[model samples]
Target: MHTIEIQKEPVELYKILKFEGMTSTGGEAKLLIGDGQVTVNGETETRRRRKMMNGDVIGFRGDQFHLQLSTHTETI
Candidate 1:
């Protein structure tokens, strides 16, 4: 797992998506979300601005992350 510390307590969907290199732009994340390629807490997530609260889990493809308080860990 790779750790990523953020300046804020909670992060938006687009931020983590880009931080994980899942997409280069918010547009890409929107498309991916709309296509049901993103998962939140083990279910398909379609909200582009889905607020990632601490301890939330997000998965895409084979990548997953633990959104900790003020930090996010990328699990490969």
Candidate 2:
């Protein structure tokens, strides 16, 4: 399993897919999701803008990922 850290809560599904390189573009992510190629928590997720938070598991194309919130402090 892989972990993807996000700075915020409630990220859109397609954005994560695109950001994680699961899809080449946001449009591709949308299509993939719409085609039922993605799963959330072991169930098929067809909502492209589905809200995803920490602890959510996403599976696609034989790869699984766990969503986590970045806890590292950032220095300006």
Candidate 3:
């Protein structure tokens, strides 16, 4: 499991994929998403930018990610 911190309550599914080094392009993320290769909250995720948000758990590529909305104190 990996923890991804963001500045907002939600993050797009595509961003997660890219962040995890899954792919370099959003287009590729979409393709992987649509193929049922991505999972949101333990289910297949179809939305490219699914707005993960805080506390939203997403699973993809055999890994689970916990999304946390970051504060100014936190650095990227």
TM-score of every model versus the real structure: 0.76, 0.94, 0.81
Off by over 4 Å in 2: none
Ranking by lDDT: 2, 3, 1
Model 3, position 64: C-alpha lDDT score: 83
Give the per-residue Cα lDDT of candidate 2 at 39.
Answer: 98
lDDT of 2 by residue, 1-76 (tens): 9999998989999999998888899999999999999999999999999999999999999989999998988899
Query: What is the C-alpha lDDT profile of model 1 across 41-62, one tens digit per residue?
Result: 8999988888887777888887
| Candidate 1 residue pairs in clash (backbone atoms < 3 Å) | none
lDDT of each: 0.77, 0.95, 0.79
Count of clashing pairs, candidate 3: 6
Least lDDT summed over 10 consecutive residues: which range in candidate 3?
A: 67-76
- Per-residue alpha-carbon lDDT of candidate 3 for residues 1-76, written as tens digits (9 for 90 to 100): 8887877655678977787687888888889898888887878878777777788777776788888877667448
Q: Which candidate tops lDDT?
A: 2
